[model samples]
Target: MPAVTTKFNEDDTLDMEMFEVNIKAQLDAGVSGIILGGTLGKASTLTGEEKQQLIRETVKMVAGAVPVIINIAEQTTKAAIEAARVAKECGARGLMILPPMRYKANDYETVTYVKAIANSTDLPIMIYNNPVDYGIEVTLDMFEEMLECKNIEAVKESTRDISNITRIKARFGDRLKVFTGVDTLGMESILMGADGWVAGLVCAFPAETCTIYELSKVGKMAEALEIYRWFLPILELDINPQLAQNIKMAEVATGIGTEHVRAPRLPLIGAERERVAKIISDGLAKRPNLPAYKGLSMA
Candidate 1:
């Protein structure tokens, strides 16, 4: 697969029109596939019905141009199963699932969490592992257990621990597709045998990310690093869990999407917006030689 990019949200709100535009733009920019309702899409705030609507609209708009993966995250396994069923019925190409958030589950409970969603649908499942947010890490042994679940075919690795990725690739390279969830690690992860990348910064600079991915794929390390340096500032913002909000702000400043996130997310404003805008502006200014910099005039 090329690389899976997410649909950038405005604030935490779902603007179907803007979401469609973002997806179409990423596809045109050369992403391998699209992952809707993932972290960047603020899946938590969306109701089950809203998520179904998001999936149906995304599928309709994509028109099979690329695979669309819907994220099914809920407080309960039953709710996740229902959401997964709806995702399949709405024409999603696959499903990405995060572990239950409110309560920390032990290894056995975690296995059940993953199994419930995997068994709920025949669509291939990509287990989303973000330890910082979930307070639980699906250990290698847990992953081994998950393999028995027929639909669990991939993993969106977000821990940034290279060793874990190395071990997973060495052990189950044949059975699972490993995709890096961190944007800054895109090149390195791909170089380390990751099947693909699920990127958030791609929302701000899809064309730039496409360039980096292409360069890395072609063994153009020097060139890829040159582009990667320009992305570091924005990537720094993503280190926090508030990446969804930061990405949306960058999108607004860059004319990619609206900056209208929903409640509890507290849309960036005042100093926060100013700081984010300055970072983006400075990053663009520093990379005068980049195509994205030149394209800023067009934007």
Candidate 2:
């Protein structure tokens, strides 16, 4: 699953042309799903109507080839439930939801918020446990409380603690799917048994990112590592505060996207643009000739 960037026109309108192009690349790369309107998608700046439109169009374009998931990051439980409702109504196959965005809710509040959204819609849910950036860790205990909700099927493990994969498996077994949300740690996490990758830099380099996951899952570590090592510098861009600009710039390099971003967020300028440009160029110049891996076997 790629946490794909939402393409925008220079006028700040949705860039469906480029958006479809990137989505096609990901599907061709053998990704299991397409995740829209996440952090990488600039969900914060998107209007409710725009989000619904995105979900509807992506669902249509995907046409059940793979699941189309919508990210729900609302400030209130009521609004969150509404987001869920919209996702389902617009034909999203699943939802990747964050905890309350406005308030730093405690464990009880957070649990209630997540469960409320889960119960409101029949769509399968993947909780975004990105405390490193989002500031509230969904601990094992909290997951225990949430386990009874059958729709809460997966967790995007963004805690950056590799051990948490072991911990989740130890505590929940196969009850909950685990997907690494960090781009740099994708190979390690999959090797440690993460079910999938909710990737970032994948927006720019879909085949390389998916190839790493597929190779790692099949124990082809040496081949995977070669690409992963080359991919590291580009992956690091995903961790930066200006990741949207950095990755979108890379999309431009790959000819799959544009540099346009929404208001309050500007395109990369001067030194930052030059620095990221060098990384993208270097990575592409040395881009590995991926081995003829046997099968897709996507994570």
Candidate 3:
């Protein structure tokens, strides 16, 4: 599952053509699902109508090949409920929801907000428990509280704590699925028995990302680590503040996207651009020839 990037034209309009291109690539790489309108998708910058449009288009394009998940990152409970309603109407198969954005709600408030949205729709929900960037940890205790809501299915664990994966497994077992949202920790998290990855860099390099996951799934760590080590420098871009731009740079280099971010976020420039470009360039220069491992039925 990739928390996919939103493609934009020079005028900052939705580039559905390029967006479809990338989605096709992900589907071809055998990703289990498609995630739209998240942090990488510039959900904060996109209007509600744009997000709904994305959901509808993606659902149509995917045509039930895999679940099309829309990210619900609204600030208010009402808005979140409405978002969920629209997503379901637009054929969204699931929702990747974050805690109340812009406001750090306590555990009780957070659980209430999430439950309200979950109750509004029957669509499955994946909680975005990213305390590192989002500032509110949906602890195991909170997960226990949410167990009653059958729609709240999985978690995109971005706590940056590897032990949290084990703890989640030890606590919930198979009741809740765990997907590491951190790109650099993907292989480790998978090796540690994470169910999947809510990935970022997969926007640019889906083959490598899926290859690593597929390889690791079948006990091929030696092969997986070979690509992972080579992928680390470029994968580190996903952890940066300018992560969207950084990964877009790789996309541009790889001919999958352009560097046309919205107004508040201009394309990366100066030392930052050069530095990121060099990292991507280095990674591309030594890009490993992936073995033809058909573990995940990659196209």
Candidate 2's C-alpha runs over 4 A off are 294-299
lDDT for each residue of candidate 3 in 1-299, tens digit (9 for 90 to 100):
98999999998899999989999999998899999988899989999889988998998889999999999998999999999999889899999999999999999999999999998999999999888888999999999988789988899999999999999999999999999999999999998999999999999999999999998888888989999999999999999888999988888888888887887988888998889989999899999998876654422
Q: Could you tell me which residue pairs clash in candidate 3?
A: none
Which residue runs does candidate 1 get wrong by more than 4 Å? 1-13, 287-299
What local distance difference test score does each model get? Answer: 0.77, 0.91, 0.91
- Candidate 1 residue 219 Cα shift, in angstroms, is 1.0
For model 2, residues 90-118, the per-residue Cα lDDT tens digits are 99999999988968999999999999899
Candidate 1, overall lDDT?
0.77
Candidate 1 vs 2: which has more lDDT: 2
Give model 2's TM-score versus the native structure: 0.98
Residues 1-299, candidate 1: write the lDDT tens digits: 32222343444445677776777778777777778777777777767777777778877887888888887778888888888888888899898888887888888998988997887778999999889667888888999999999789989898888666788989997698898888778888988888787888888778788777776766667877888987888877777767777887777766767767666776677987788879888987775354332112211
Quote the lDDT for 191 in model 1.
87
- Measured with C-alpha atoms, the lDDT of residue 182 in candidate 3 is 97
